[model samples]
Target: MSGRAAAEKSGAMTGANEFKLTQGPEDSVSAVKFSPSSAQFLLVSSWDCTVRLFDVSANSMRMKYQHLAPVLDCAFYDPAHAWSGGLDNQLKTHDLNTDQDTIVGTHDAPIRCVEYCPEVNVMVTGSWDMSVRLWDPRTPCNAGTFTQPEKVYTLSVAVYTLAVFQLSVSVFQLSVSVFQLSGCVSAECLVRLALVMLTRCVCFQGYVLSSIEGRVAVEYLDPSLEVQKKKYAFKCHRLKENGIEQVFPVNAISFHSVHNTFATGGSDGFVNIWDPFNKKRLCQFHRYPTSIASLAFSTDGSLLAIASSYMQEQGDVSHPADAVFIRQVTDAETKPK
Candidate 1:
């Protein structure tokens, strides 16, 4: 990190400290992702039915993209060109450069997650309709689809030094290319008619899936039996009450851009950073007053944007209001705690 950038990252806050963004979404903001190419830029998706672009340094919303319904998740193909999926059951690409929005795909039910793997050169979208589809940016038509055995809620994708990754594949190829990770679960809305899986994230060589059951499942890509052999699962985001274990749904996960590390947030009202390489927690944040709906690490690994918001059954008053926090993360903080 450059001196100026590092100063902006940490400034005078040596101990646990975070800077609040200016004006934030009026409604619960469920997702906060830093731009892939720059740490100063970020995108926020919210129940307010809008996706706003912001300059992290300025803390100002520079642009707003509206959808017919609440946006569940989003991914940037580039700084200007990105994809968003929402309750409208539509996946649309919003081009910041031209300010043009194009609807490229539709789902039988609402789309739950959207991800882009640059190395593999593909975009994946998962929906409640029990399907995940892959698309080639070169064309609007879906290049492939993965029909899950159960209703799908969330997913993620990663790339490695494989010869190539293709969506259309034989049984053998699918055994290698198919990755079924977890998704995001919002804690703000009522859970009466909804089953939630809100977010997932692509880790180093594979992906991490977080569930309402308070578990994080780590699995890798194919082609290497050893990598797959290292796959494992663990319990997290849980609390004990009256000698009984009460589990909270995992709401979001964000990988450190440079640290080979990742963070998981849940309704337990905490964000835990982990070094999966060592199978240990680097740090745990306990300042949030409510469930953590979303998390994203900046491109340089110097900053993390956290959205602590309400996402539960309606009329719940345990927590109210929504806000975003930008914290400076350093090597010292990543030390085992």
Candidate 2:
């Protein structure tokens, strides 16, 4: 970890507050997200090829949309207009007001992740085909396409950069005119570390990457080498036994919008709140029974959604069902100890 981060994390610690159990999909939930306009509204994408809309305030499913294949990831461009990507490799927009669906673009392989950059009026999708393509919803046409050496497993959008990464553990930065990739985090080391960074989100100037290796890297997007030197990673979600680290993969990461503090969920079934500035966990969240596949904070950061699913780590799921958890967040959760 960087000295800057170490200096910041020295004085903070938090406890994971419990989660409010909510009914979810009959199948393993792939992602859990809150609406950009309001925290009361949430969405859950499942391997069952369905997306369920829930009224969190009411604790009821509001509407359900089914696709041709399992839905992998989704994002809202706005309250009424949103997009969903699935195993079908198709990106489609769903109109919440009318409940209508429309195709936006296509990927050669399953669309593992999608992100909306409201400032640029563009949508980005990462795929198994090893490409990241930009789409302009206004024209229903692709703005541009960029290829990577490995399968693109996740995508995230910041003010000036688009992050595309693969499970092999590399991140790429894409812009409208210039695209650059910082030094790759060695895949072998990542594998040895065993953190599966399948889910990631843009925080501010940097992106938070979680790994199955039991570490989460705080990476800088800047192309300059000196600034890049400031980037560092920390080990979390692990245990000490015989002085050997029994690390659990950090399966999910979500950044709070207002505070910039992020939350991490892991195979250990625990979710923790962190202040990247301090580079320390501010609080720990209630643990679950299964691995956390995804995490999302509402636009206002008033609510947090956690999804527990079959991560393929346990072979066959004994219960064969997924769960959803939403917790109302308070400022105290992120307060430095």
Candidate 3:
């Protein structure tokens, strides 16, 4: 379907204003991130081996840069700089102001996630090599590398805290580990959310982890046994057909910066907002043409950028073209009742 048609379908379902970008990545869009300070600019990384910065307010691609291989993830270090890594096994920093690119470092395996932690003033990259490496954004040097129990599938930052999902799909295992990147250069595991299933994506609003089995865990950042008791898991994105149950992986998640509520996107092509405090779903947007690969809420929580792309989680198959939909969100859709 065309971008406009998809937007119409989505807008009708949630009653939220929506539009499609005039241009999008050539291949599957791996990630969509809004700037830390402003919502007008969005950073997108794709399997096309390029990262593009889009001026969402104007619906135009402002700048783009290429990588040797597919770019898996990208994050805005600040308004002027972006950090990205992917199949090339290399980490790169791009100066948005000058449009210059520099190779920072390399990982043994493909990098899956890139995140900037402002509180600690550090850049973090997670990889399939089973390690999380820290880089000093100012100096452009590797500060430290910490090993994980399994391959790092996703990483989320909440203040000085970093939440990492160590996943092993073959055995259906997952470890939700939290690291405090404060005083020391090396990271220390503050807490583990217990061994679960294969985790496809995670977002921090008190550290939320979603698995491939259509289950999501909401846990608190505080490691105290009492606060841990408040943590719970719920099943979603599952359908029953002909008495058989089919579960889709929750591929992406983003939290509303203002409301503290969150949205989850799944391979089922659906996105839903939830009130974690109330354990209720606020609303579910209309399904897209294909899988929902990534999601990002603008800084002030007035906008949400959704990437509908094919993840190939079921292996290579026919699917719709990749697209990014920018929706004007409201308190009714994001704010908890």
Candidate 4:
């Protein structure tokens, strides 16, 4: 085994309260999200064309369902219902109670993000077709479709606001736009900001955007000039060795529900917790075996699920095995000092 693999194995064996999922995805994991109401169940979507429901308490996969193509993202509509979209350009809902899958709708291109808005009781999907679609989860029908300036890359909904990140016509730039969701599926464009190469986004009291250039930006939803001035961007996930610097993509972000602090995972195989409100980094964990494809903190912020999967970005290199790790977190590591 390579030295890096040996070091990772040693760390996994010694890390406190950390355990690897023995029955992980066959291909790269695209998303890992916990149940909205409970931490015991986890929802995982993978490039293997499967979505799995795992019982973390029992450390076993409860069940799994298949798709025609690789699943890109998945969300829990409720405790027993899951919503997923994929390269097949199809939106599907799985009924855990009955082991049934229903085709909700289809996009013009591969679906990139799937999210459920509890406040509006709507299921929102973003696609590379350059459109955002809203669905009525109960009826599982398309409520509306809104065109975007470019291909939708990621989506995050906070309270009444929805933030959508898209690739710009310029190959080097990304556009970040925010929308206000009114009654049910009604959406109104609020603001648009341009940045460099966005890869992932997450929204809470405000919005946090990560770029392929190893940087992260924190922006607010308010339109006031003073409120907007508080927005700032910083660099991370870069290393300097032998008089050269290597930069990696920041792939995932998950917020701690109770503390409002957030964690970011990168291709550098590192996870760092930050207090965005205070502009401070709380802690940085030891490196994993490979890149972090996705991350999710349990509803109560007591556990964090890390998806360490190789993204094949380096081309024809020796790739590490894909795996998922569950770690019990503590207040000292997540809470602001």
Candidate 5:
């Protein structure tokens, strides 16, 4: 089959041949993740304010636990516990096999994102209040908090995005790095989030173009510093006029673990993979029907899982309509030049 034909046959929009894993409710899945171990368990956070663990081999729920607020995100630690954050501004860890949960730490504002760093045994939480907090997972306590300037307007509240990584142990020393992105003010915020570690130092790439009406100006930051500085280094090259108009705000970004590549998914229903070092677009996947809210790469960097949402309106009530899609990223030469 041709590339397009193969994509359509493999699932695309019909959802007929797609490997669908339904949990909670048809629309409740907010985030879906695979464990970092060899077992490859699937963990999901839902709009029902709970985190559900599934044994993918059996396609069954192994465990579920409720949180203080809607569970926005969940990730597994290296050992066995799962870490989660949500609207309650608290980070909670749960042991799936034991059915126990403990609040590890609290944020000053609604928690928007959570990630586990196994190399450092740390949990990172981002908040809508413009700050990212780091916690010790073993102790369930705050290790450090990175704060940003407060917004002047309620609509301008900073929603943070975070990524953590560890530098390779070399002849020098061992170091752990945390990267964060803050100050997003767009209907479809496409913030580029990444952690590129050299031998001893790490650099974070956070990019979101500032906009007046709809036009955007990009900004960059390195989170390792005490005073986070803006680099304003990159610009979005207009690929196509219609594409530019359709460049929905970016919702989630993931970097290739082994290469200089990264992918950005947006509300515009497009996932663009780029080479950050060369500042070139490698491939574009544009088959999504809604805004891509979150993304994850398999530990081996072979597969990508995307969480997406569509807007729904009922009388006066407004809620996000969501779904998950798993895609395989192929090499550049394998795709059409």
Candidate 6:
């Protein structure tokens, strides 16, 4: 395997030198994510049509499930059950302990991505059918579905790119914060932002907040009905194409837990960071030989874990598979003006 050495500067370290784990059942891997608890556990989705959980510290497999179609994406609902979606047009949940799984429901088209709310039992899925569906795994029924314009598969294709935050939850009601990208024609079009409110009765209230295509918006959800009355939004910047312009679609997006930062990667073979608070590009790193499949930030936002597929022509003619890179993000020094 040919590996590039990232500079040893304060903010740069060899992401390829971090902890590595190999997951085998043979299909191409689509997505891999770390739990909110940091390095404790990780969830992975594969084209082999299954979701596998790995013990990061021990580099061992804890559990696995067969979703029946190429499991395109997976996300943890907590640390226990994971929500997985794929070409089967089905949304399913897998229990990490029992190694059991059930099909919650089906979508009109293949489900491309799934995400769980940080502070609640709700989950949302994006699909090629041009709709985002919300579900309460606790109920195993449809909670809500947000429909977008026709020919808007970009939103669904980018669904794995979705992010969620809790707004509020009470004995009677629950509120969630979510955003999606629209109007992406190719690489030049800016992604438009659509923010929506989801309630327990399966009601959806959506509104457009911005028309920038590649940018990501984030918000904190209030748990109380009263606090849910306030409006807030943050934007994430995309990397500028200064070198070769490749048409790799961005597959995933992640935000730092405590910092006003976020990261995005795509088939373009680069991972870029941004300050969500100020909407400024922080820095960019490129060393992956293939498309970036997924990204995760450590609990303290100190380490970044990246999963990528290996590209051919770069060497390693045998045993071609996916690789993971871990990067350390350092704070910049302040200089007096």
Please report the candidate that would top TM-score against the real structure.
4
Kindly list the per-residue Cα lDDT of model 6 for residues 193-302, writing each as its tens digit.
23343210111112212212333333333346665444344433233577743343455566665564567765556777765445456777765756566777766766
State which candidate, 2 or 6, has the greater lDDT: 2
Two-way lDDT contest, 1 vs 3, winner: 3
Candidate 5 residues 1-337, lDDT tens each? 3322443544443333233333433444556667776334667787678887765434346788888778777878754788887778778888876889888777776675666654455666656566656677666678776553331011111224343222222332222222333322112223323322221112234443321121222334444564244333342312357544422344456656546366666546666776644555787765665656556666666556667665231233555546666555666611323
- By TM-score, the better pick of 1 and 2 is 2
Better of 1 and 2 by lDDT: 2
Instruction: Please give the RMSD of candidate 1 to the true structure.
Output: 8.6
lDDT of 1 at 162: 17
- lDDT of model 3 at residue 335? 89
RMSD of 5: 11.2
Lowest lDDT 10-residue stretch of candidate 6: 199-208
lDDT of 3 by residue, 214-265 (tens): 9998978766899988899999998789999999999988999889999999
- Order of candidate numbers by lDDT, starting with the best: 3, 4, 2, 1, 6, 5
TM-score attained by model 5: 0.63
Better of 3 and 4 by lDDT: 3
lDDT of 3 at 191: 80
Pairwise TM-score winner, candidates 1 and 6? 1
**In model 4, where is the ten-residue run with the lowest total lDDT?**
1-10
Residue 245, candidate 5: Cα error in Å is 3.1
Candidate lDDT (C-alpha), each: 0.69, 0.71, 0.88, 0.88, 0.53, 0.56
Residue-level error in angstroms, candidate 4, position 191:
0.9
lDDT of candidate 1?
0.69
lDDT, candidate 3, equals 0.88
On lDDT, the candidate that comes out on top is 3
Q: How accurate is candidate 6 locally (lDDT)?
A: 0.56
Q: Supply every candidate's count of residue pairs whose N, Cα or C atoms clash at under 3 angstroms.
A: 14, 15, 0, 0, 5, 10
For model 1, residues 1-337, the per-residue Cα lDDT tens digits are 4323433554422234565565678888867888889888888888888888877776566788888999988888888887888899989888977888899989888887777767656777877776777777657667776665444455555542211122222221211124432222111111111123332332334556666678887765444787778878888888889999988878888887676678888888899998787787878876576788899889888888888888873455656668777787887665443
Error in Å for residue 267 of model 2: 0.7
